[model samples]
Target: GVLPLAGLGAWVAGAGPVVLPLVIACFGLVAWGLHRRRARADCGETKIHKEGVKP
Candidate 1:
């Protein structure tokens, strides 16, 4: 949210085309971090449909 808002502000301030790409990259990083955390929580398996899956 902050990254996108800052990017928008930069674009409004005439920082040119770099703002959107930067914002997108920031969002991607955030999403990747979340995905990694979730993967770690499931022991890197990415799917845990059974109740006895946890060690």
Candidate 2:
């Protein structure tokens, strides 16, 4: 997320002040998405592995 946003900012501002906020926002969104995914998995969600593996 941050990677793409920083790219956008750099394209827009050419390595100026706007890049920082864009990078921060991108990072925040990615972090939030990861946190949400983790939370969902923790609350009794079952994941299936490959067939050869024993559970």
Highest TM-score model number: 2
Report every candidate's CA lDDT: 0.76, 0.75
Candidate 1 — which pairs collide? Answer: none
- Compared with the true structure, model 2 gives a TM-score of 0.53
The ten-residue window of minimal lDDT in model 2 covers: 44-53
Prediction RMSDs, each to the true structure: 5.5, 6.8
Expressed as tens digits, the lDDT of each residue in 1-55 for candidate 2 is: 7999787766858766767688789989999999998988765344333433555
Off by over 4 Å in 1: 1-16, 44-55
Q: CA shift at 9, candidate 1, in angstroms?
A: 8.6
How does each model score on TM-score? 0.51, 0.53
Name every residue pair that clashes in candidate 2.
none
Off by over 4 Å in 2: 1-14, 46-55
Please provide, for model 1 over 1-55, each residue's C-alpha lDDT reduced to its tens digit, 9 standing for 90 to 100: 6999897686756966767678779989999999999878887454554534665
